[model samples]
Target: MTQGLKIVIVEDDALIAMDLADLLIGMGHDVCAIASTESEAIVTARRCKPDLMIVDGGLQEGNGIDAMRRIATEGFIPHLFVTGDPQRLAQGAPDAVIVGKPFTMRELSRGIAAALASGVPASAD
Candidate 1:
């Protein structure tokens, strides 16, 4: 509605990934990439240079914390943690605004708004 963000989604579950992508599109954001693994997430993030990343806290390989640890080093890209276990993500990514999984699109939208306003995911270092 306002100006959509270029976004990337790092999620392992294929159905969940598609749902997220749809939600982003409904919100008028462009989904640059959708990755299911840490390596893929990193590679796609670099290639896409997205304005924001909505990442699952856990993945089959390395998890979002691991991916963000690396992404942070390259500089800041705002990120939101969408996962079931908020506590786990909070411990790993204190600066991120986490949204637990099974969340409503409205709730996820709120989290996105907050993260965008926050600006720049904090460096893991």
Candidate 2:
């Protein structure tokens, strides 16, 4: 298996963030940081330099699409979006790898695999 990847989670829900962190640890991946807002996500990604990022498409304070765009300006980092409204994210990022909300482990794993495999770099535009 590949080495455990360092990851950052951008989720506004505290419980969900913890759950995601726990799940990632169980999967042998290390969660470097968790952010609850777009600004926080950008700062955390910069500080943590995680190999991957799992972002929520909709956030109460700040949305994920804007956060990803800002972070992408620094450099491309493998990432996936988890959201209830896939179409919304699709409209903003046509190439993004997305996992639906309330996903099973299998689905999340597949999404992560696809996200990692995708070569398209994140773009601000």
Candidate 3:
């Protein structure tokens, strides 16, 4: 049996972040941290060392893509982008998974499962 995933949320929107956290926790995953800015996200991800990360496209301090890149370069967590704008994700780090905003719990669960199954390496650059 697969172990429960450890997750980190990087969303600027308080409500969305809380909702996602609640959903993931309800699904039996451990939420390590929730961050609203790029720097905080990166720091939290590094410190928490979670198995999965759900990041928003926009942040108060910087873009989520940049944070993803930094995390990748540091040889850390596998991450997915959750955003309303697919166009913004197009410019994201290569091979990054993009889960559109307004996603149902089922959709988010599926996306996380797929990302875990793929076993993709964390970004190296």
Candidate 4:
């Protein structure tokens, strides 16, 4: 798929993660890893150095923001937050790109592009 953006998916639900993986692959992006908890996400991100991460707003063990914060220490790893509750994350990460849950493929794509274009998550829409 032309060495598309290497992405890490951080979601607590297995079914959701699987669906996300399929979506990313269909979009020609590479899913380097899938993590279900904050700790797993941080660890995977540190090891993989993916181009970007798609993180859930609320995670299993901890939270997405905290995990992303730790992961970003290595460098500017852009992120797209997908959650039913966007308001909470917006306060913690004002400029971070986000898409509400039940996002259409178009919305997710736009968020990804916006986050990558800025090299740090940017305001989407």
Candidate 5:
């Protein structure tokens, strides 16, 4: 409903990454970059400085939560974690917005809204 956001997606699965990119584009948001690993995610975030990040909680090469924690050192960026184990993140980060795996577009949208609304500007660690 607001202006389209610049987003970076941190997902390891190639198909999932493409799907998410397409979905975001269709939703009027810009998909600046897609990162398949934690290092890539960190670098991409720094280079793109996206308005938001949709990160997979468990990456093939590294952990998404670790990537986010490292990225947060630079500054807080609104983010939503997509994970199969939502309870883990919820318990660790009660204030953070998280969406479980096999999520619906509606769920993703709500998580994005909540993350942006939070706007705490603090490290996600």
Candidate 6:
């Protein structure tokens, strides 16, 4: 059997972060870390080295795009943008896989699976 994916979430909203974590856990994926600020997210991501990362656009210390860029520059990880602002994401993170806010579990699941199937480091570029 395939191993469950390890995921990290970087979302400032408490309810949304918990909900997303619950959904991912319910889907049999492991949530390795959840961060509310950009600095925390960066630290957690580096420490956890998750198979996939879902980041919100808005963060306390910095934006998710900055976190993604940091992760990319540091090394490799599958990263997806889960945000409310698609326009900004389009301009700033054109290459990222996006799952808009208020996304269904099915959508999130599909995005995770797709990201995994494509290979972890593949999405970084």
The lDDT-based order of candidates, best leading, equals 2, 1, 5, 4, 3, 6
Model 1 spans > 4 angstroms off: 120-125
The candidate maximizing TM-score is: 2
Residue pairs with backbone overlap in model 6: none
Candidate 6, run of 10 with poorest lDDT: 116-125
Each candidate's clash count = 0, 0, 0, 0, 0, 0
| Per-residue accuracy of model 6 over 1-125 as CA lDDT, tens digit each | 13488889999999999998998888788999999988888899889999888889878779888887777778777877788876777677666677887798777777676655654432233
lDDT tens digits, residue span 68-116, model 1? 7788788677888899999877887787889997899778888888888
**Candidate 1 backbone collisions, by pair:** none
Score each candidate by Cα lDDT. 0.86, 0.89, 0.80, 0.85, 0.86, 0.79
RMSD of 4: 3.4
Q: Over the stretch 1-125, how does candidate 3's per-residue lDDT look in tens digits?
A: 23488899999999999999998888888998999999998899879998988889888889888887777777746677888986657565556677887888777877787666665643434
- In model 3, residue pairs whose N, Cα or C atoms come closer than 3 Å (at least 3 residues apart or on different chains), thus clashing, are none
Deviation (Å) of 79 in candidate 2: 0.1
TM-score of each: 0.92, 0.93, 0.87, 0.90, 0.91, 0.87
> In candidate 4, which residue pairs clash?
none
Runs in model 5 with CA error above 4 Å?
Answer: 121-125
- Answer with 3 or 6, whichever has the higher lDDT: 3
Any residue pairs clashing in model 5, and if so which? none
Instruction: Output the lDDT of residue 109, model 4.
Output: 88
lDDT by residue for model 5 (1-125), tens: 54599999999999988998998899999999999999999999999999999999889999777888888889888998898998886765666688998889889889889888987532354
